[model samples]
Target chain A: MRNRMNQRQECRLTVGTLTDAMRAQSLLSASAIRSEIVGADGVRERREGCGYALTFSCLQEGQVRRILREAGLRRF
Target chain B: MIYLDHAATSFPKPREVLSEMTRCMRFYGGNPGRGSHSLSLAAAEKVYACRRAVAELVGSRHPERLAFTLNATSAINTVVKGLLRTGDHVLISDMEHNAVLRPVARLAREGRITYTVFPTMLLEEGRSPARITARLARLVRPNTRMLICAHASNVCSASLPLEVLGEFCRKRGILFVVDAAQSLGHLPIDVEEMKIDALCAPGHKGLLGPQGSGFFLLGEGVEAETLIEGGSGYHSLEEEMPAEMPERYEAGTLPTPAIAGLLAGIGEVRRMGIDAIHAHECRLIAHLARRLSYLPEVTLYAPQYQGSVLSFGIAGRSAEEVGLALNRMGFCVRAGFHCSALGHRTLGTDATGTVRVSVGYCTTEAQIDALADAAQRLCRRT
Candidate 1:
């Protein structure tokens, strides 16, 4: 019983550590996206807060268009 | 031809309101209360200034006593959920919006608090304030801790005589909460003179602000528990919520751009003057109600001297049918119960509901004329 409890606590700690790392990485990448030029920055950056996941690389134009579309931006 | 649903959400917000919101989005864009840098400080200041403006408008001495919520509904919930415990009794009015009724009803069903509702209509139109005061004086029980009411009805725009109600609550040593979502910026409110313990209002309705901006003002010495406990950026060591007024009530990141828009909106309202706006809207509403009453098929609800809102029914058509017909003619008005089901039932308009036409500061006399013409045409058609 003691061993099982210890394993659960270790698993929780591991998950928490991973979450913090992901948050830090996203924050850094979003800043890079804002600062970097629109095109030719192969790593396409995206700005998202809290519960967002980066499924595509920062440099993908298709992914950028998809993100903008999903955000309800329209062509005038 | 007209948009007469200001009671739901005011349209065509002041141009400066949009510009200020855009400016916040373009620059000084930072999470308020999250950092001590210049950008964060500017964002925080923008929010604080709005709190101060709201406090001054409502006659609150301290701006920090106000807390921001998504809307008055959530603000009322935050207070109702935070304050009441098991076996507590409350007093309410017959004209309350569901924002107050639903939460209180649920709590009553849960056995947390039971309540009594008083009818303000007994006072009559142009009735002396003392009549309403006498009615309320008879309703207060020993166990009653709070008396919450809508200062103005969204359905009919009939304003409750707050001076009498406020004094009644004061003399009984009970707390009084006023829902001012419909009349805060459009009508002059003096919380100090009114003896209002708490007021919940939405920024989008009469304040000409963007969506998701609203606040609650609590009187001194009336502290409700914090429902959401998290980082308020004030204390890093403490695990529990802070015991401060707004800081304790405000948890997590606030909508900074919304607050910026709210500050700009309040400035425009202050420049125009709430009394002037109230007079303008009342004139338009009274004109529209008078014209509608002249139509043989029209059945107007509430007195002709109500505020900016007017509710009516066509003898031959459903409220929804008439509303849609008006909409087809380029008019926008709200139909149905307006979220006051119990009140509608009490008034015997539950089945068909009432068509509501509410005006705002930007609403012109010509628009009211057009609305009256549309109603005439619809009546002719039916």
Candidate 2:
């Protein structure tokens, strides 16, 4: 279950739940977009009471965000 | 051990089931849907994959609508308690397990609703879908909000015609719920084709998964009150679980290792096709039934139905005695009511509580022959 993830990636999408992260991850995977879900410990990951983010190495930020939004993912 | 108690829970699970569970505990033992680390997400993905696999196997298009629960009993409680309301009436089959009966009975005891026992053609000479539907039609009332029944009896081979009952419920605007405890992996189920409002099944039995894994799959247009409320990994900002399908019902962290085992179990079942598994078990039951029928002391119930389970008793020895004797002789069989009072009463085994022998996909002809010979010896002693 080992995966290569860029922890310092610039493109990161923060989601509400683990299920949402999984959904967004699956959608992005199907679209040939590689992303990794990590603990949302970043300042941007802070919410009222949540902490799970999906990180991406994509240069095209718009497309990744678009896929996340299209999949109805609740993001920060 | 010659385990024949599959109706209780499958034993000697496939190597894949055992290996996957060990892998999950070792590699990704995080709480599913509870965390966001690599191990957590990996576990979450495995759980989702299992849901998708189950949905596909049961012909449910909405994998998200399938929620994992402790077992079929908890799922049935969620549905029966969540959906039923005051002034609502329910109809249950005579062969329903306690899972279906208890919740419905509790609701009725609280006087929130009422229920009627609809007879099934367990012993009728010429049973067919038409006859079964006609009998159900006779019991249907305008206030009948739901029809909860088992896909197959837990103690015997009698199974209801789900397609016919589903159509009847749809026509009457009644929710059709099925308890597939004894039939999930052993019989064909199409939630979409059957028009089932809710389908409950245990992963341990026919699916060959370990204990502690089961699922509740909801059909379109079916909504039930949240039976339990807690931290749904998502929507913690709000007090209510989100209106989403799974997150709505799954209030707490899911069982990851058991789900991982279930994923492997489903893989094994798929490797041996559903039809092939069912036919193999039924063939074994048929052979055993044929052999036992020759003994004048033996009486087989629900012999005509083609399924993985069969029930019988010896005239001289009580079911408890026979079950113990079989155990001593290295043949494992379940005796007594099997938690299905309604089923035993309907099948006329309430007094004797027939000894139940449930086969599985891996059960062989040699095992059936051995069990048959043991049964014959028991009969001869009588």
Candidate 3:
């Protein structure tokens, strides 16, 4: 079937596209609510939006003890 | 497995049904009229094709005249809520399920709609046709706006004399609505031929489809406004709902996969032919009823008008007891009111209820024999 407009223009909205848009909106909301960032050597971590992230991979054994004490908690 | 509950919902759906539904879910799974993509267009086409197919099956002139619903109950609700208001009267048969009966009762209690229930007349053996017609004509009232009846009784499988009732409604200008949940794919129905203004059917039942799919055929001149509102995909710019036939009634997202399965089910029915299926069920009912009559303990409810169901009660045994015993024997049976309290009362079996053994197209002679044997064993135990 030939239309006055191009093939893509002729059909702007279809079933698949609408469902994709609805699903995308849902994913975007989740992305905005919580976030996590990772740095090299498994050494650094950051938490965004709601809570704090504790980094401990490359720190000395004694340094971890001091950080836990300052946060008012002990690691078993 | 022996499937005798096809009257409730057909089991062992045609292989094509499952395959086609899977195809829709995999390749064309998209919200209809809600997007702009190739897959979405395919999904919309599938839904539209089903609508057109269903409309043609029920003698609807236009596909848009019919509206898809969750089940027959939902369709009935749309009609009851949208069209009826305070002071209007709705008439229904005594054989109605709680789906229709309870809603009407609530309406009556709140003083929204004055409702009347007409009795279902039974025929005597060797009775003439004229006697049955006269019995139905007496129920029509001047204030009755709608006359709702089941096409066939779920409790007894008695085929109603809708042709005669249709004539009565035509003369009185009453809107004749049929609750076709029990009859729709098991029996041939043409709304125009039967003078039915609206027909409600469950897709999961006789239509041999998934549970969430059902549609109502709206006859000409039945002006039912939408019971719900919001997105209809076509007229998104309009703040108000669409004024078109189906779009007016349909709001929000439709169950695409279920409707796709329903369309496939209808296609299977078309191929096998509904008349052939009906004939097969009638034969099964006849055989079952005849065998049941031989047992002294069996109390056949509707011996004269056995259609697709054979409802009976074992003397001295409660319906639930018999149902449990039958279940242990690998036979499934439904007992109690079957959600038709009025039907039970009208049949004079409300106190004890009755064991209903309904058959469908897939029911075989072996299953019927098993049912008869199970009843005999139960009868002996009682």
**Quality of model 2 by C-alpha lDDT:** 0.85
Native contact fraction, candidates in order: 0.00, 0.38, 0.03
- 2 against 3, candidate with superior TM-score: 2
Q: What lDDT tens digits, residue by residue, belong to model 3 across residues B1-382?
A: 4666676677878787788889988989987765545676578668777877887888875565778999999998887767776777888887898878877788889988888777665434554435554655676566778788888888987767677777778888888888899998888888888888888888888778888888787887788878789877654555877665676777988988889999999998888898998888888888999899999999999767757887889999999988888888887778887999888888889999998888876788888988898888878887
| TM-score of candidate 2 relative to the true fold | 0.92
Task: Give candidate 3's whole-model lDDT.
Answer: 0.72
Ten-residue segment with the worst summed lDDT in candidate 3 chain B? B121-130
Kindly list the per-residue Cα lDDT of model 2 for residues B1-382, writing each as its tens digit: 7989889999889999999999999999988767666777788889989988998999976677889999989999998898998999999999989888888888899999999999887888888889888888988888999999999888888788899899999999999999999889988999988989999999999999999999899887789999999987755677777777787898888899999999999999999998999889888999999989898999898788888888998997899999999999998999999999999998888887989999998788999899989988988888
- Stretches of candidate 3 above 4 Å error? A1-76, B123-137
What CAPRI class is candidate 1? incorrect
Please give the distance, in angstroms, between residue B297's alpha carbon in candidate 3 and its true position after superposition: 1.3
User: TM-scores, in order shown?
Assistant: 0.82, 0.92, 0.81
For each candidate in the order shown, give its overall lDDT on alpha carbons.
0.75, 0.85, 0.72
Name model 1 segments beyond 4 Å from true: A1-76, B122-127
Each candidate's number of clashing pairs is 6, 0, 9
Deviation in angstroms for B36 in model 2? 2.2
- lDDT (tens digit, per residue) of candidate 1 on B1-382: 5678989998889999999999998998887656545576567667777887898888886676789999999899988878777887888888889999999999999888999887776226645667766777787777889999988888776677787778888988888899998889888898999999889999888899999999899998888987787877554455877666677888888888898998999999999999999999888988998899899999887645568888899998999998899899999999889998756765668888999998998999998999889899988988
